[model samples]
Target: MIDAEEKIVQMADLEIDPAQIAAYIALLAEEIEASVDKEPGVLMLHAVSVKGSPAKIRILEVYAGRAAYEAHLKTPHFLKYKLATANMVKSLDLVALDPIAMCSK
Candidate 1:
């Protein structure tokens, strides 16, 4: 297990059409929740959207560290998600953050 002192944050901004954004988010969340347990060092996954921006999606993913985050990106589930959602996403912005604290012990 990773030390609680180490944490990582991943933020994603996705641009999608308003009509399909809700369905896309629901599907993505289900996929994330289903796949997270298999991902090593993943602490939690939180997905959100702006109140006024139905087309925008924001994700906050917490991992054990940089290595964990990298591994997560390479997972089959993530790859599948990327491929499946390619058409739904118009643009994406991903940011990696340094961790100050973690929920995992």
Candidate 2:
């Protein structure tokens, strides 16, 4: 078993169809809320759009570990978001991250 998932991070870059921005955002927010509320392993799912680029979106996701990440993929909310936004998404890119140190005041 792969333990220690609290350090897992993922960066997703998305390009959405301008015509579907509102609808896609609604679905994405709904799913994010559901995942964060219902899934214990989901640490965070933050979505943002580039300045002056409404069609460009980016998401920063943090999970407890590998297991948690995989579990997220199979969740109902994630599936719903995936299916609903398939046509709206023009491109998607996922990047994995390794944590070294974090400092906060």
Q: Quantify all predictions' global Cα lDDT against the true fold.
A: 0.78, 0.88
**For candidate 1, lDDT tens digit of each residue in 9-76?**
77887888676776788778766876677976777887878888878888888888878878888888
The reply for model 2, stretches above 4 Å from the true place, is 1-6, 100-105
Question: Which lDDT tens digits does candidate 2 get at residues 62-90?
Answer: 88887888999999889989999999999
- Minimal lDDT window, size 10, model 1: 96-105
Model 2 gets an lDDT of 0.88
Worst 10 residues of 2 by lDDT: 1-10
- Please give the RMSD of candidate 1 to the true structure: 2.8
